[model samples]
Target: MNAHEIVAAVSSRRASAVEIVRATLDRIAAAKALNAVVTVDSERSLSDAATIDRRLQLGESIPLAGVPVVIKDNIWVDGWRVTQGSRLFADFVAPCDAIAVERLKKAGAVVVGMGATSEFACKGVTTSLLFGSARHPLDPDLTPGGSSGGPATAVAADLVPLAIGTDAGGSSRRPPAHVGIVGFKPSYGAIPYGPGFAEPFFGISVIAPIARNVADAALAFEAMAGPDARDSDSALVESSDVDSSDLRVAFSPKLGLDTPVDPAISERLEVVVEHLAKTGLRSVRRDPVWPPGATEEALMPLQHGGLAELYGAAFQKDPEQFDPDVARQIERGLSLRGVDVIAALGASSAITTAFAEFFREFDLLLAPTVPCVAWPLAQLGPKVIGGKEVSPRVHAAFTPFVNHARLPAITIPCGCDGNGLPFGIQIIARRGRDRLLLRAATRIEDEIRALPH
Candidate 1:
């Protein structure tokens, strides 16, 4: 059942919370081949569900009563072992619940387990020494994308109705697109960040919700959003309802980046855009004019430097303990000069300003969530796209800038490629316009669903 259905059934006593959670646990056990879950505390989850049942008997309203949810391994779930897909943290147990988990529990969602992530939630593909790799539910040989792959896989495979993941550079958004699920990244600070692991992305990362549909994602978002004294970046941003008739949408196939999109993906998105235009929203083919140094390459210093700053000492002592990809990032970070970090921050600021200016003329922007569909799990990313060899980061081309600008964005499955692999279209809005983005995404999702396959 979806979160709403589970909530209604449990609240009415038609199905007890214990029954729901037990069945969810069974599903997780049966789907272990996906390698999507890192830890499952069946005992704690059942206990929590029983508590929800007791609360309901006392006449309390719970927004997510009896809904089983998985949190990304990078986020804390008090007492749960969160390895962050790295051996370095393999033995680390969380001492307290992250703000998101605390809020989820308060809303009556049962924490079933922790989802897998790329080591330190840094890479785009989910694989590590601690937990082998997370496979795509649709095709086990392919990946679901990462580092939110575990959450995306769990949701898409129907193991849970909802999940929470972190998005620094498409970590949450792209994976859901690959797995054909809804991933919503709120504006920076929409959800209070942590009492957990130190963030490598620092100011850019936000806790995101992953679910089968936009409504479930939004429901989770509602429960987790709002300010907290612990997270100075967090604030209460009232969602502004969007009027469909007055909305201005822009469709940028490549997000105006000199990125190569798979011909199949490009063709499919064009068709989706055509359908959206028929829905009465004014959408034009316009791309944001990005500043010269706003590309993902220019922003690497922040990630590398952050990793070096946080884990460099540990890495220096034993680099083998870190993921090879992450280790290289740390090594590069260690070599970066202060001016290099400063320049990257400046570039990020320029990207933010560019988007702010772009939004002045457009209420929403649509782009392909990823350039290609799920690729072989053995590789980090597709070696080529649109008949051209590209960098491993090419799959992430359309997404990082949204995080860089700290804007609200979401990815919904739009169509399948020739191989029947799903791809998604992303809808982005100005910071603090999360409500508008979700509402528009729902409309577009419905329109896509109605189209003949």
Candidate 2:
């Protein structure tokens, strides 16, 4: 069940918070070998659940009363020992909660535990020197996707129905695509960032949610999103809504670049588009290029700077103690000069602006969440999929740009590829247009039947 169902189920007395919490603990225990979780504080969660039961018995109401939830280990929650999946701060217990976690708790979500992540979420794989690696629950030999993979893997394995994760560069989106769940990142800063941390130098990551499906993701998004004194970059409240019908989409199997796309993904994407076409939704072929409208190929250089800015504090504390991979990323980020950063920032702006007119013409942009299904677990990155050794990070291309531009994008599980790995179709909307993205996502899911590869 999604969070809403979980909340309602516990509320109507069809079940108790203890029942939901118990099942989650069992699933987490059974999946212990997966290592998708770095920590599972079962005792604390049950104690919180008992408190919820007392509230329900007193007829007191809470929005998400009795809901069991998990948060990516990166974000802070009081006493959670927020690891961010790196050993640098491995011993740090947050003095307070991240704005998103605090909101969830305020809405009555019982904090079940925390999810695993790639070291500092710098790499694409969910492996770190700190907590080993997070493997796919379905096939341990394959990847569970990165950054947010731990939380998503937990959700997909039925460990918990809702999880709060952060997506800087497809951390939230691609993981769900890999694990066959829905990951939704609202326009950046929608859920607010922190009193402890601030925005990255470049707009590359945000606190987001992963759930069993789009609707549940949206509900969680709603519960967590809003202006907070801490996150000034959050979208301003406006009178707008997601539409129910008459959607316009730009479907690109490959996002206009001749990358090595798996045949399975290419074929499955077409079927999804074909189904959408049946609903009278206009579909077009447009190259929604990354870096938006910038003429230079500069995502990596610019992203590195942001990486350093976000995790620089850790670097100062214990640079050598950090994950070697994460330290490497910081070194690369710190090496960038002012001119390089300025050029890259300009390129990002051009890219963001280029999409302005495109978004006006298209209500939603549709593409495979990743160019291909999950790669082998042992591989560091794709060796050669479509005749090119694409950056492992770029395989999950559909999401990062949205994060960089701070736009709302959601991935809905349309169908699976031949390898049995899930391939998702991403729906993007204007900045702050989360409702529209959610609506189109639901329509596509309802319309598309499972197409066997």
lDDT by residue for model 1 over 260-279, one digit each (tens)? 98898899888888887787
**Each prediction's Cα lDDT score?**
0.92, 0.77
Worst 10 residues of 2 by lDDT: 289-298
lDDT of 2 by residue, 225-300 (tens): 8888877776653334544466667877766555677777777778778766767776988866544344324666
TM-score of each: 0.98, 0.93
Q: How close is candidate 2 to the true structure, as a TM-score?
A: 0.93
* Ten residues in sequence with the least summed lDDT for candidate 1: 236-245
Model 1 misplaced regions, further than 4 Å: 240-244
Candidate 1 Cα deviation (angstroms), residue 4: 1.0
